[model samples]
Target: MAPPNLPFRLIRPAPDPVLAEAVLRLLETPEPASEALAELAMRDAPFTLALLSMRPLQPGEATTLKRALTERIDEAGDALLRAWLMHTGSQQLQADAVGQLNMRAGQVAETAMHLAIELRYPRPDEAYLAGLWHHVGALSLLASTRDFPVLRDQPATALERRQAERQRFGIDQIQLAAWLAESCGLPPTLRDALALAGAHEEHVAGAHPLARILRAAIHIAGPDATLDEAARLTGLDTERLSNLKTDVDYLSTEGLKSLGIGAPGAAEHERKPSGYPMLPSGWRAVALGGLLAGAFEGIDGKRLSLRLGNAFRLLFGKTPPLMLTVTEGQVQPLPMDTAQVAPHLITELGLQVDDDTSVVALALRTQASTSHFPGGDGPGRSTRDWHLARWLGTAGILCVPWQIEDTPGVAVVGLDEHLDLPTEEQQLMARLVSGAARALAAERTRRRAMDQLGETLMASQREHIRRVTHEIKSPLTVIKSYLGVIGQRHPEDPTLATELNQVSQEIDRVGRLLGQLAHPESATEEPRSTSVSGVVQELQHVYGEPLFGQRNRELEIRIPGGLPPVAIPASTLKQVLLNLVRNAAEALPEGHRLTISSPGVLITDGRHSLELELADNGPGIPEPRLHHLFEAAESSKGGEHQGLGLSIVKDLLGQFGSYIFCRTHPERGTRFNLFIPLAKPA
Candidate 1:
């Protein structure tokens, strides 16, 4: 079955200089540099008005023409179609508006290129290239004039046009734009802005390239605004008013004057070469210009976003001045370009800021920072900018730095608000920042611990003194009471007196334990004589108890023949030896032989001394528990032993500028080696 041939109506001969010349000039530099593409699109934003007044195309013809245009180019038809639809209002029409969109896009692109060349916004070729598609919908709208009566005549007032559009078709041009945007798979930013273009009530949105270029291009072209109320409602200030009044008339009357061939007035704009890099031209403008007073917001480093669809929109369609609102705490990752930004309703989403430090900062840190962490696949980070430029899917991210409660560091958080995407570097930075916050929290915790420890120490000392006093007094009281009772009641019984004697013995034992506990040095004062050999012998006799030994263990104490013990305090040495032996016994396994080995343990303070070592074959202590194994009260915390054992050993040993510790092993056994002074004829 052959398709029916469609009717062909000759497009009216356009305004001699105004129509044909503009299109011809647009065709001059069709291929511009990439950076200039955005500026070109912006300059040609009002492409719909131009095509409407210049070349009127029917929906069918426009569709065919659009197919021809894109097919002529070596790009994917689907990609071109999608990109165009996203930026245009063409989808609102029953048939295709491709032809009108294509033609107007080409013209606008060319004109914007020329404007870019004049303005000096980097590469004019690229700007003009993008300018071509600045108004796909506008051209589409103009092309469909034969089918839709709503667009029959250009209204005198903006409100009248809006009302007429709503009455006739239940939607304004913006809705058409949104329809096209959705059909083309445009970025959310573009789709949203296009949908709200004519929705005055919803104008609190950010200024995206879709809106900025569309409206700005119209203003650049012959502006058809006639209503004062419309101006007030749209918030068109005096500067915009004057620019529209002058630029519009100039473009309309002069037919693209000098084509910006050599105009110094247009030289201020920056240009860019056509290549994949950090940002598009509009973003460059934002970075340099700071904000769009026309759009009314300061969109800086925080509100920047790059959308590939928007790039196409700016390159091949008309757009409007975008409105943007940005706050610091709100941040998101742009799916199209994989850029990071804060919460924003933007008109011109172009400001691109390059932060290199942010890259390394997130890379080195990947720890948790918050108590409640939302689960995700992994951290977000990217070393290469292009890896993040996948336009396959839509994703959103929000990152905010927060100090974790009771934690030491600040944390950055990434969110997929709609779960559209899970960006990389954007997430990583958030996590890294969070880790730092946790570190800060940890430091704070340590400080608080130290303060509490000091307070505890003070209170503990008073309690210990009180307990010691009571212990000392209680023994004396019992002895005195026993004596009194024996003299009064046991006067006629010898057996009663013997019972009293046993009571006295118990009281003496308590008194001895208390004395040892209270004054470590007061038990027995040993003469200050450095007798290393005698010290070893005394230690062996004291620790020779069999009850403390393991079932299969043999406790052996040996002093090699070459050893010399010249000077030492007998009591302190005894205490140190006793502590080591006790610890060794505790650590030894049942039925295992324990040997105290003193290898060549060196001791020197610019002088010679003795070396003693006690090595046993038993289970070795774990490495993690080694550092604090001899910190007095902390050694036996896991066991039912008073922490004072190692504490007394260390304290007595410190006074002699010497120390004693044993290296314990697992497979072979434990060894306690000590270095005692061996002076020669001192």
Candidate 2:
């Protein structure tokens, strides 16, 4: 409901149909340039206001509306501009009323530019802007009231027309236009020009230069003002004024032609029925419900809101309703595919739910639908609501609250000030909200179920690992006890005693490895420097007897003296060397020799590294097998061999920033090279 003192609702003026069609035709080209769009936007006051209203303003930044219009067109690009134009052009106004207003604005704009040049005004462009938008209040009145057209066409002076406007609407066009300029945060100079442009001749004569220019331009552009009267008002010679009038008339006529208004059949074409038929209420509800169901199919929790927003747009058209998510007392916009709202604007437009005078806040507190018109003369209007209206680029807002289980939110729908929301439409909106809420709840439930199943599987895997560790530890304990008994019984032989101690050390290593399997999170060890020669000597002692001596194969080591230590743990390096030597010994024939050598320090990838090679003269790996040699595969050696030796070797080398590569030829032999990084000095 509106205030009792207000005679009519205040709404944004509908865009001129001719100008809108011209812009639409421009957009029809495969790629419409933004410069052309900016020029078109500057010509129409309503289009200019719409563009400036949607642009996000920085705090304390002083940007003129005309400059901001060009910046926004360039930033928003073609797709968003087309969508906004299509949405704004959908609303129909009286064709005659729109045409009359457009022509008047054009004539005033041209006349003002000519007058500013003659008077040598400092800001001629601003003078033109003031002239073009001085009549904006009339457009608003036409949109807000039915009888404004009759009042607009009266054959009276400017003062008489203003008096009649004040008597009927309790406010004149100048005041309304001023208020709109203030709401858009236009510069105070421009606002003052708009506010005082319709003053009496005596008052405007002593006013600011822009106000005086606007008043004289309006007079010259009027139907009844004579050339002599315009010259007297501006203090110019009649001959000069007549020449300016001729130019203004020609320019205004050209402007009208460019807008497609004076062309043949343009008026008749605009007068036809422009509204599309709508479906019945029940069918609309069913259609929306079907779409909402499809939105939820195969969608996870993360994408549920995005898909729901898309469904809302598809059902409600381009000027779709906005869905805002409420969390921790703040409201935010839901994600959408298109950039309907810019990211920076979203950050600036976020609202608090605790605000007392906000209708959106009221909707959230009471859990009901609410509407507000920030441009109206109602009592409880807040500055925040005014800012929201400007940011949304709408005259009115409708807020519908929704809740999904524990989460509560609101859906903000843009509305025209004079358009009342029907009961059936409201009901359908409620159904849409309810359907979206239910989908959200279902998605939440599915996510919780999946989390629970993952936890159960992880627990089962941990328990199986524990049982396997226990079984392996039993055999390891028995082997250690038998080695202890043999060491005690073989003390008479020093060589045998030394071998027994080596076996005991290997058994302890197996025990430590078993402990790591049960507690894998504690397996990481700090890196340490190991002597390359020391690790090679230890490998020869540990595996030489069983792997090479028992197989009747020769082992050759060619480590140079004074080699730098490698940046790997001693235990880890020993384990890697043991695996490689064991593999070579098993694969080589009875008398084949395995050679382990270090070719000294070499620079690799801008780092000093030790080049270690293990070469064997055995039958080289087949080409097909060598391609996937490092991958874990079935063992050709059979019988409990998992064939994971090369894979494990690669993984261990990677953990220490080392690299390994193999070159094998069936005729020549096979060689494995390891580039181990050298340790840096402490």
Candidate 3:
């Protein structure tokens, strides 16, 4: 069947992954896949023979054949069968041939099972199924070639006939079918059978289990073949074959018993039939109680205690006694010999085992101050056993952890009902007892460093607050006294009256000392959602009392009406406008234009959530202090400011997530942008 350019091979090589994948997609169409294979078969005589050889099987057996094909494809995990079969027969894999081949396959399986069972193979059923399907390729070829006169007629010998057929054609049917299984990635057992079909010396030398199975099926299906002789070839006793045959037949038709699979999930509802020991009555309580007390402390006591009680009921078949230890920190387990540990335990107050109990080991790894435990009310001699027992009595179980704070290195928690200790816990206790010896020493090293740092910062803040307070207050007292003297002398004199008024103003100027207190919040509000145009109109009347008159200032409004609202609070917007414009008023030799605008707000220029810009014509904002303007007490060169106003503006804007920044150049008046988030609906 090779093309002119193609080299001679028993079967074509392979199909493309893309074409194979596409074939699976095509399979979903209602058109019959078997029809496709049959059509391909018609065009290729040899392939046609192989395809037809698989039909005419019983219905149940046909289903099994379909399962076998699925098994083959799954094991292959290939997406290319589509392309490979296109030249051969894609439809051969479907239902038309599925039923007959599947039934024949089951018959093969039944025969193999019988043969293997008679042989006493441990896995008789598996051996039978494997044996039955071993030479599917050869069987398919034999069936398809049967319609040919020479092939259908009796041959002097099966092997001789096969060789004769091969000589006449480039390859025989068996060879071609065998090649097909290999190309399709059939399981090893079936693949080997393709090589062994003729009972050739090299191909059938050792008679693999599958080959033996095929030999038995041949005997069962061929009346002339003797069952005893065939059974002997498979290492099976003829007497047992019939029974195995019945069982295999039943399995093929009725299915394997689910319980016999021996997997756990399959047996979940059934009690284990055998194999186990009588578990110790209180091992869980004994083990878990120590771990719980050491790890969680008093809060877990009730839950852990309940768990222990339930464990006791399970083990004893009745509820039994269990112990619990409740302490603020860890309930340690200590054996009787822990008194020798106090001196070392003073440091590192953490969970640890004590020298006494071999079963209970420390479990919690807490982060806490590990200062050496202080000596008790007074140190006095006490027997180690009595002391440890008292700890056990008080804490419920005896335990030891290095000093948690300034406490005993070990405390007793509880005794488990198991009344036995684990070897590991005993070792942990030894390590704890050893570590206690130096725990306190480490605490002393850390304690010294902390004490020195605390003393230094405390003294520094004290002196700084004191020195500054006195320096500022002295002049204030003198100013108040001078004002008082002037008032008494002037009574009604114009000169003295003017002098007194100046003193009062000086006091107010000095009172800006409040900025030194860092009260950024105390500064009045900033410009907010207040009407930009209306505010400009009312400015003169509102501030008439303090103005040298908006006189020299040229007020300009860049704001457009009906603009989207800003986030500014009305009161704060007014206050901020007053301070900025007032500062601008103070800066100019005379009045200058003030301009405000409506524009998109930009964030990220500063940390403010929203920003608005206010502009003025007075000598541009100084470059050096532009960024620092928001810092307390900052000032522009040659321009004196109380400094708190801008700082306070920054702080008040912070409340509503708004901010202001200025863009200014020598020729251009400063433009201060005020930004705020568009407010969300309440």
Q: Which tens-of-lDDT digit does each residue in 1-682 have in candidate 1?
A: 1111112211111111122223333334555232232222233433332222212223333223333232222221122222222222211232223322333444444444434444444444334423443444444444444534345356557667756656654555555545544443344544454454454533522454334333333334322443343233335564555554455344532433333221212232321111112344345333322211111122222211212212212322211101111223212222212233222321132222232323212321222221111224333343221112111111212323333553222222222133222232223233333333343334446668989999999678756965876767686877768676766775888755655565464455456556666655567654555555566654554345542442456667666655655456765676677676777677777766666556654657655656666676767777776666677545443657876776677777777766666576568766655555555564
lDDT of 3 at 374: 14
Model 1 misplaced stretches (Cα beyond 4 Å): 1-530, 547-552, 560-568, 597-605, 632-639, 642-652, 660-662, 679-682
Query: Which candidate leads in TM-score?
Result: 2
- Model 3 scores a C-alpha lDDT of 0.44
Tell me the tens digit of each residue's lDDT in model 3 across 1-682: 2211111212221122222333455455565354443322222222222321222222233224444333323221211222123322321222222223334454565666566555665555344434444434433443334322354254568776666656654455466655545433344555465456556433453767666666666565442546675666665576666565555555544322221211111233432222112224255234333432332222222333333232222111122121212245543332222222342232233423332222222322321111111123431232333344333332123333444344334323333222223433433332323232233234344557778888888777656755776677678878888888878877878765765665565465444543344343465544445554555444543443245354655555566565445566655565577677676666655646666555644556443243345677667767777768778864442456667777787787778777677677775677777766654434
Q: Give the candidates in order of lDDT, highest first.
A: 2, 3, 1
Off by over 4 Å in 2: 1-279, 302-361, 369-400, 411-441, 521-529, 602-608
User: What C-alpha root-mean-square deviation, in Å, does candidate 2 show against the real structure?
Assistant: 13.1
* lDDT: worst 10-residue window of model 1: 318-327
lDDT of each: 0.41, 0.70, 0.44
Instruction: Report the C-alpha displacement of residue 60, candidate 1, in angstroms.
Output: 73
RMSD of 3: 28.3
By TM-score: ranked, best first = 2, 3, 1
In angstroms, the error of model 2 at 93 is: 14
